[model samples]
Target: MDYRKIREAIIEETSRTHVHLVEVLGDTITTRLLKDFPEVSQVKLRISKPAAFSDCDAVGIEFLVHR
Candidate 1:
């Protein structure tokens, strides 16, 4: 697999996305990865929002996609 292409895909998706929810972002990224990299069988994604709460480090969402 071309790691550079994969990285560029992720960057492009993230940079162009305007979604507010982490779950939606995760889904978007996962979908883009699967579409861009057919050889990939699975995608495990984690998205975080730092300092979402005063007492905790961050809030985030994680999900896995299989092809």
Candidate 2:
């Protein structure tokens, strides 16, 4: 599949799951992507949202997955 298709699939699946946690979302994506692309042995995902405080731009979480 192409990059566009892979991206669309990820977005669709993530929305369907209705999961809010960054860690869970990263893990879920890693698992699903790895199934289709065995050459990918690692996935590094980062999620950021508007900062709760006025000090910075955003707050985020990063998850690294290895198979």
Candidate 3:
């Protein structure tokens, strides 16, 4: 697999996405990855927002996808 190409694809999708929810962003990224890279059987993604609360270090959502 071309790691550079994969990274570029992810970056492209992220830059173009304009979503209000983290879940939707994650889904968009996962969908792009699966579509662009057929060899990728699974995807593990974490979307985090640091300093989201004074009491916590960060808040985020993680998801695993299988193709």
Candidate 4:
């Protein structure tokens, strides 16, 4: 596990993390994920709507929260 490879693996794992903005369930999901993955002591949640627009193909918000 080289440093860069380990970092890339972490990045890849985190890349799949998401929160859907419309359902108001992002918080719930975040809480659950935080509980399930203790490695995630804190996380910067990014919610986006890439399909909601054409120009930017996205809009989002970030929340820096911790358990």
Candidate 5:
């Protein structure tokens, strides 16, 4: 996603283009949240910033499986 400007300009030039790190953190947090609260089965996360007219930082991801 670092060089995602080749296709979608909006995704590369938006104030909320943090799906990368957002989802990663989402998965992590989701795992923890699930552990603490088993009632919730779904989690969605989003992170955004202001950088280069769009704003974004490196993103990492992780997911957890509940059994």
Candidate 6:
């Protein structure tokens, strides 16, 4: 798997977003990966908002994408 490409895409897309929702970010990353990498039939993304809460460890979302 070309992890470097995937990471670059995710970073490029997610870094300049007005909507900071984890679900949206996850979906965007998955879509980008699927489009860029045909070998990736499925993508699983986990986002953790570590600074969102003071008491809890983190609040995040997980998403799965399938072609």
Give the number of the best model, judged by lDDT. 3
Instruction: Report the number of clashing residue pairs per model.
Output: 0, 0, 0, 0, 1, 0
Best candidate (score: TM-score): 1
Per-model CA lDDT versus the true structure: 0.89, 0.76, 0.91, 0.58, 0.45, 0.85
The residue-level lDDT of candidate 6 at 66 comes to 89
lDDT of 3: 0.91
How would you encode candidate 4's per-residue C-alpha lDDT over 17-41 as one tens digit per residue? 6534433444654565566566667
Q: Model 6, 1-67: lDDT tens per residue? A: 8789888888898887676577887887888889999999998888898969888989999888789
Candidate 3 has which clashing residue pairs, if any?
Answer: none
Clashes of 5: 1
Q: Clashing pairs in model 4?
A: none
Error of 6 at 8 (Å): 1.0
Which 10 residues in a row give candidate 2 its minimum summed lDDT? 17-26
Give candidate 1's TM-score. 0.91
Error of 3 at 20 (Å): 1.6
| TM-score of each model, in listed order | 0.91, 0.70, 0.89, 0.49, 0.36, 0.85
Whichever of 1 and 4 has more lDDT, that candidate is 1
**Candidate 1's residue-wise lDDT over 29-53, tens digit each?**
8999999899999999888999999
Tell me the TM-score of model 4: 0.49
Q: What lDDT tens digits, residue by residue, belong to model 2 across residues 1-67?
A: 4777668768976888677676677777778877877777877778776864599998788878788
**Preferred candidate (lDDT higher): 3 or 6:** 3
Q: Write the per-residue lDDT of candidate 5 for residues 1-67, one digit (tens) a residue.
A: 2224322433433333444555554555555555555565654434443353434653334454554
